[model samples]
Target: MSTSGGRPRRSRSTAVRRRPADRRQQILDAAARAFSEGGYHAVRLDQIADDAGISAAALYRHFPNKYALFCETTSGLAERLAVAIAGVESDQPDPRTELSELLATIATTAIDNRRTGGLYRWESQYLDRSDAEPVRSVVITQHRRMRTQLIRIRPELSRADADLITSAMTSVVASPATHRASLPIRDAQTLLRDVAAGLVDVELPVPRLEPPAPAGLAPSAKREIILAESISLFAARGFHDVTIEEIGAASGVPASGVYRHFSGKAAILEAAFWRASDRTTACITDALAVSSTPREAIVELVRRYVEVWCGNRDLIMVYASEIGHLEPDRRTALRRQQRINVEEWTTWVVRSRPELGAARARYLVHAALAAISDLVRLDRSSEPARIGPLAQRILLGA
Candidate 1:
């Protein structure tokens, strides 16, 4: 009864299922886990069925094939995005805060809710017209809604410029460069806040959001191994430089068996990237719950962020140096994602520091990113403590 894959790769020989409702949810849940872990291409119905404790034949009875399942998976994510943003109506209040709440939700949803967001992030490969128009239309509409919001917030700007800024900011959120390799470290919120500051031109501070770790909540040893190996592969080679073959060998999984966990290279890359973004965002949100003042919040936020940025420089190198190597369509989609991450950061920059105009804030945020991203890709690790002090100087004037 389980469906697998973003678009489940189906076997023609499987028998069709009979019960519609129960069967569909079973398939969808399995599909969700599978798609979230890998992506559409890696999903296989046999695997889904096994996860669901059903025969492959039973799965096909409800859904026609893999493509059918993919359509179902990605169907409403973008529409919800549009709807969520559209609900943030407020001309009387500070436009910057309004945008932050709206965008923060997007970062959380896109970065955390793996199935829906994963489809939003990675399903472009299957977006042929023959596939379906609903998901595509929803995403477009959501983007358009965001554009309108940008225009209102920056009333001094031209429509084209507003659109451009909107486009650029959204791309930042989705970018792999902003994604942390495997944990909700500090960089997620920092990168998001940076992008927003870059787009809107602001001097607001980054806020911390993570809470203290509870018992039994730390990452497992297995997760660490995956991250350490991926960092090497992504750093030395580009995204495509190391294959699942290399990753499997480095991580100690059987090459053929890697598909059991991750179906393809891109999906694996996406997962690794997701680990970075999700953990970062979680950290920020958690910190926000406890920090008493904006300055303290910003300090902790930046401290965690600098540590993460320095520690994972190799992964950042792999992500940045190799992203252009992705197929053209993926490149475009990821560009949009990258924008979102930046805009999230930019929002905080604007909110916390009202001194600079939008233009100046935008410049500073992007400039800061430019200054720091270089350090991220550097392979030399001799000077261990440089990033923290430097980041404090940038944000805290300490």
Candidate 2:
């Protein structure tokens, strides 16, 4: 019998064909749960199969390897999430509000898809060289898309600021699952809203929770101690999603004592960021001082920077975000340092690709710095092999 759509209403055979697709979903769901609750290293295929209410052998028929299945599952989830975020419905007239809806979509979608969220939490690392590069391309496209939309809403935004905010917003939304009992979704939404608003020259008054107790860290160790804690949290949670108290607690310092050393949470963030950025700049700067070829110097600098930071990327997250939150004087100082560093970067680029002028060189440097900055907190520190390839792409653009 023909159905209204001009197809057979149901055949036992056709019905059976649909079942595998559904079962694939079930396996993905279980895998997400297993991966999210515990990361990739800990996930067990047998247990995942059990969670899916299937035998391991059956599951293997659908997904031969755990990593392969995970990448397939999470790739879909990320795409769906990216689409949901891209299609946010809002009419705020303000760029920030629009961006807020978009980010809120990401956070809420993740929250709703607790299993997938867990998968993201657990299996983000499994997206290795092959898996990650395509996703990065998609992300970059989305970034450019959103930035174009933002500029339409607020034309005053500097390309640098737009790029920075876009990067930070992405980090915040994709940050780990929060145990924030009272205000997880709301808080996440608000952070995005405020960031977007700030982009459009609007002032968003958000609450700042009370600062934690000051820690008795020696001057030299204070920064390291904070970096130690912040690296993991930022690496796991991203910058906007993590709080000062969490950093303090993770660092094994009494929350209150941390404030005694810095002015405020943002300022603490500011200090921590500069520490790492300066170190990186120093390494690069020092390399530039002696190396003959600008290209060689740049490569070595990026190589050293990548090696050190990828090993401890959580610190880089703090560096990436914290600098932006500083006071004008502090921000100026930090920017000045970065500017001097960029001059070297610009020189290298101009020499290698003569068509790319100083302005383009600066943007290239910024983008590369932005990408490399993320490596600090990578869970698999052994991903050193990945960094040189990334460095080449970012700085050289071939």
TM-score of each candidate structure, all chains considered together: 0.43, 0.43
Candidate 1 lDDT over 132-250, as tens digits, reads 56666766665665666666677776654454445445544443224333324234545454554346642223222454234344354654566567767766644545777787788
Per-prediction backbone clash count:
61, 18
- Superposition error at 235 for model 1 (Å): 21
Predicted candidate 2 versus true structure: per-residue lDDT over 188-229, tens digit per residue: 455434433333332222223454235345445765677566
All candidates: CA RMSD (Å): 15.9, 20.0
Best by lDDT: 2
Assess the local accuracy of residue 316 in candidate 1 as a C-alpha lDDT between 0 and 100. Answer: 62
**Given candidate 1, what's the lDDT at residue 118?**
47
